[model samples]
Target: NYNVLEQVYDVTKFLEDHPGGDEVLLSATGKDATDDFEDVGHSSTARAMMDEFYVGDIDTATIPANVKYTPPKQPHYNQDKTPEFIIKLLQFLVPLIILAVAVGVRFYTKSPSA
Candidate 1:
């Protein structure tokens, strides 16, 4: 299980070296950052200080009804990374051949246990 206390202490020490901002780490406290808890050894409940300690002061956004973000211009340069069919076939074949060799070696090396 994740220990919130331990995490807080560790986070405090690491905060000084944090590049982006200390607020980012502070905000991650009560939130769930673990994607796979089943395999993880530690976890913690992140505090909802995102509103309280985040980088900038909280202010209401004022976007006009007709205002829209200007889209970036798409890159016109093209290297044409298309590959031939035979090249793709060889790439697929090489991995399968290696795997088959590995499995064959394991099977040959296996001996029944008493």
Candidate 2:
């Protein structure tokens, strides 16, 4: 119920929308919200909401409904073109090097007069 991570996230998000700036939110993060408890109508609902974020088994809380949840697509290693790219590069360069060497040898070995 007293997990600070969720509260920190909520406070950060709230700061973006608050007209009065984020001083209050920053202060609230460190103290128990007891004095301002009755100022808002849904105090119990708020506490209940915070309680759910206490996922003991997991380090991170489940994504909130306001956030559209998306599981990351698995990396498609099959689509990796690195090997193909390297092969193509070698295919183009290898013959060029061999041809250059052959030409150099032919030029040097030709009759000194011719």
Candidate 3:
């Protein structure tokens, strides 16, 4: 029996069908597996599926003091990275543009030599 969120779940039937494999579920037995569950970032459908295995709730008094439920941190997806070629191109072009602007400024601002 796997304990998660103070609820008991009999995942015996789900062991073979689990995407992570039976070992993962077996390892979660006899303990609060909420952290493992949350860490996997199971989808809403997966969460709904667990309802079928729901057995009962664990008594709060019987739970150990060390056992606490802390939600997993959300993963950061960085979509801001420019393509390598684009970055390299920018690196080459920016300095060239600045040099061109400096040269143009110097040329225009120079005093006419008599």
Candidate 4:
């Protein structure tokens, strides 16, 4: 049984026909395979074909807390980005400052002489 997006699919018959191999599907057993299935970027035809294997929706209450799917952790990057942040802040501020100065100059120039 393969669970994807809260729906269950009985893919036992599809094992042999799977392009990647039966091992791929077998690895996804007893777990949510939404990420695995999406990572392959299956074609529309393949997606449509999945309907034939559809069994029913998963009962969330039946799934053990430990068995719940958890996404892979993302790598942590360097936390200290003061320099990069300053550069980006200046990039935005400089253009805004220039625009404001231009607008001020235009406004002052257009004012009638006293």
Candidate 5:
């Protein structure tokens, strides 16, 4: 079983074509081969080849609790430390402040009669 999904594959047939050799596949027989398979960094073609050998999925209830897969949780952003609101406000206001100053300087530099 791999990632809580039972993979039915023809080890005998795959062994003949396996680039790593038959011994590697033999060692993983009747066991979860996910770690070994990932560590090798198999090519996309190798992953695609699995489709032909797939039989069907195993029920999640049948899988042992310890071996069940859970996706990694995403890290939460600390908004309090970064002050995102203030950063966004400054981003919007800074350009307007510069434009206002430029206009004021141009007006002041002009002659009263102009």
Candidate 6:
């Protein structure tokens, strides 16, 4: 009754053959084991052995009530907007440039000392 990447696998019979031990496989019964399987870093031969135990694809409609399916997030971007680096540069430089121009104007307009 274990699900791995949407595939149903009956590991109950293969429990004794599991290299990690029967307890490890038994612990993952009736649950998604994709993460656990990948984390264990099973060898290529071990991966090939999975086909022997695979029963069929999990029926999406029949999934248990507790299982929550999350849809992938959509990527968001403003294609028409200016690039972030350019916008940041303008934000930083525009004020400094205006301040410099104002100071220059003040210095040029000052009367000469006697």
Highest lDDT, which number? 3
TM-score list, all predictions: 0.27, 0.29, 0.50, 0.51, 0.47, 0.50
The number of residue pairs in model 2 that clash at the backbone is 0
Summarize candidate 5's per-residue lDDT along 71-94 as a digit string, tens digits: 999899777568887898899999
Q: Which stretches of candidate 6 lie over 4 Å from their true place?
A: 1-5, 64-114
Residue 30: error of model 1 in Å? 56
Q: What lDDT tens digits, residue by residue, belong to model 6 across residues 1-114?
A: 654347889988888888899999988888788899999999999999899998988765565579677998988866547598688888999999999999999999999999
Kindly list the per-residue Cα lDDT of model 1 for residues 1-114, writing each as its tens digit.
322321212356557765546776577665443332234333343334322333332222332337677999997754445466668777999999999999999999999779
Span of ten consecutive residues with least summed lDDT in model 2: 52-61
Clashing pairs in 3: none
State the lDDT of candidate 2 residue by residue for 9-107, as single tens digits.
344545665544677556776444546545655556566755543433322335342777699998767634688978988899999999999999999
Clashes of each: 7, 0, 0, 0, 0, 0
Give per-residue CA lDDT, model 3, range 1-114, as digits (tens).
454448899999999899999999999998889999999999999999999999999776666768678999987855456487678888999999999999999999999999
Model 6: lDDT to the true structure: 0.86
Question: What TM-score number comes out for model 1?
Answer: 0.27
Candidate 4 least-lDDT 10 residues: 59-68
Model 1: worst 10 consecutive residues (lDDT sum): 1-10
Greater lDDT among 5 and 6 belongs to 6
Is 2 or 3 the stronger prediction by TM-score?
3
